[model samples]
Each structure stands twice: as structure tokens, then as C-alpha cells.
Target: MQNTTWGAIMGQPFGVIGYSNLGFVFDRDRIHEYQTYWPKEETGLARDVYIGFKYQCVEYARRFLTLKFKAAFTDIPHAHNIWALDIIEDCTKEEGTFPFVNYPNGSKEPPQFGDLIIYPYSKEQRFGHVGVILNVNLEEKYVDIGEQNYEEAGWECPEYARRLIMKIENGQYFITNKRIGKPYDNWDINEEIFGWKRIDFSQKQ
Candidate 1:
């Protein structure tokens, strides 16, 4: 199937609908080439348990954590079937599997690398979106993210994992898209963030 554009799927149903950039294979040789590949319906083992649709944001986040930190979060539901917000809830309920600490919107604690950032669902969207925190600079107040499903939109929208500027005021965190050589565009984290989950390996027992 041809890749669907952001505009084409804007008012339609959201969630993993086979539209991906990771193609079919989970190439360990080129695992770092996340941007070039589309997520497909491949499956594999993480903690001696089944995982979900490959190349999707949920799958990539889980595999990335398992491969990079030896942390396995197998309790999360199928990426293709579940809402993005439910992943956080599932992780929070799972005991002694993988540490999934949830920080609500406007959280004071800064997000760290490998954290799962959850976006809120809108009236038109049935499910929200997810991304992995690639970098965080509290001093500079910006974060770099790694995600799928958010492809480029011709000349308007940016591609996966753009750097976003963040701010903390009145005990709340806010974010803005940082475009090179252009004015910073404020992104409503207050409205967009349902919550963020961090993989705390320390909780594994």
C-alpha cells in the first residue's frame, strides 16, 4: 500500500494502520536507521514474550529499550489494537516487569532519554501518539525526540523527532517547536501531553 500523507489521514481514524517507514524487516545491522524505515507487522521476542507490530512507535520504543538497556516491557498491549494513552496505564499497572513511571502533563521533572512521551487525543483522533526521548537539555530548555508515524508534510510539517524547546513556569512544563532560523512555535504541551512514561530499570526485580 502507498504511504498515506498526514493531510489524507487528518480527519480519519488514528493509531497504527499499517502506514510506516520501517518497511518489513527489523534490521539489527541498521537498527539506528530509524528515520529511513517504516514500521510493519513483524513480531519478535523481547523478554521471552511476544511483542507487537514492528516499526510502529510502540514497538520501536519497546525494542529500543530492550536492546539498549536490557529492559523489557512486555506487558503493553498490541500497538495496532490499543490506544496510545492505554500503554502508559498498562505499564503503570504491571508489577516488577519494567519500571514505567508516569509524569502527568505540566510535570516538574524533566523528561530524560528513552522516556515515552504520550500526546493527548483530540476530538477527531481516536488515539494519541507516542515518541521516545532522544535528548534533553535542561540548560538550553530543548528536547530531541525519536518517533514514527509523523512523516514530513511536504513543506509545512517537520519530520520525525524534531528538537522542541521547553520551559518551566509556575511548576509546569511547556514546549515549543524550534525551527532553525525561524521564530520558535509554541506547542501546547499542557493540552497535548496526557502524560509521559519513563523506563526505570531500577524497578526490575
Candidate 2:
């Protein structure tokens, strides 16, 4: 893909990332950026049901689903109460609200494109992490994800979304590389995978 201004702003190609069959086809024409916010305040804050609070992993995932598939979710807490695991549980309970189907790790069925990959927090961590699958290669046993906030690129980290690779082995999935970002790097595959949920477009009615 030709390097455009947006690609230069993102500091990477909006196209394929090398010979790896596992990669993403980013919409270079689209402006992909959002403000980062955390640590919910007691003061009243306006929340957009679709775009969500800027720069949050959950926000981006929700926005992606809404824009890409025209899906929406309700009854979700507007504040920090919405944890990564909460997303899986919420979708499971409110079946037809969002186009998500929960799948625990080690299931015979693996994650596919557009799946929301959630990582649970460890004892040292306070909050979990989340990402969206951009590509999945079952034969190669790997998945590419688009995520925000988990990295340590300063305050605008959320707008600086990037792709990372996750591996699957012995019917289990794990993130082997620690270079993607912090807090996320601290997550161990054995303990972090609370589960993943796929956005079933067919469910949209």
C-alpha cells in the first residue's frame, strides 16, 4: 500500500506488514485516532454508546463493531465498572444486543477475524486488557490483533493503535512476545486468557 499521511502519522504501514500471511488491511483513508481517558472521575461524564470514551481498548473494540457491523450494546456501565471480563459476560447474558459469541480458550473452535480478544489481569495488575482480531491463520496457529492503551507510548497511546501476534499451541493460546507494550506484556498466556468473543455478523438483524 502507498504510504499516505495517515500511515505516516501512525508510524507504520496501513497495509501488509511483511511476508507473514497473518496481517491486517487497515483503511488508510480512515482517520484512526481517539483521546485516551482512564481512572473514572466522580464528576459526571458524557458517554457515547457507540464511540465510547476515547482511546480505551473497549471503546475502540466497540467502535469497530459498531462501524464495521452496525452492532450496539446496552446496560453496560458508563464508568470504570466495565472490566474486560465484563464484556464477555455481558454479551453472553444479553445475547441479541451485541453480535458477540463467547469462547473460552482450549475450545475446539479457535478465534477468528473480528473477535474481541480479552486478557485478564494478574495479581499485580489492576485492570485487564482487550483487543480486536484483525487476522487469523489456523493452519499457522496465529492471530493478529489491533489494540490500544496496553502499550507504553505516552498519553496518546490509544490513538497509536497497532497490531501484534498471538500464538496457539496444544489447543491453548498465548502471547509469546513482550515487545508489544506494557501491562499487556506482563500477561502470561496460561493465566491471562479469561476468554475471547467473536462478533457474529449473521446475528445482526
- The 0-to-1 C-alpha lDDT of every candidate, in the order given, reads 0.49, 0.46
- Tens-digit lDDT track of model 2 for 1-205: 3222211222211231211111224454533443323211321222333355444456656655554544434334431223332222122222444335667666667777666676665553346666666666666555656654444432213222433445666776654333344444444434455556765555443
Candidate 2 Cα misplacement greater than 4 A, ranges = 1-48, 75-99, 153-191, 201-205
Candidate 1, lDDT over the whole model:
0.49
Q: How many pairs of residues in model 2 come into backbone collision?
A: 0
Each prediction's RMSD over C-alphas, in Å, is: 9.9, 11.1
The TM-scores, one per candidate, come to: 0.58, 0.54
Give the number of the best model, judged by TM-score.
1
Question: Can you write out model 1's per-residue Cα lDDT over 1-205, one digit (the tens) per residue?
Answer: 2344422321111121223443355568755653322222222322242333544556656555554554545444433222233222122223335446777657887788767677656542235567667667878877766665544321122323456768778877765434333333334323455556776555454
**Candidate 2, which ten residues in sequence have the lowest lDDT sum?**
12-21
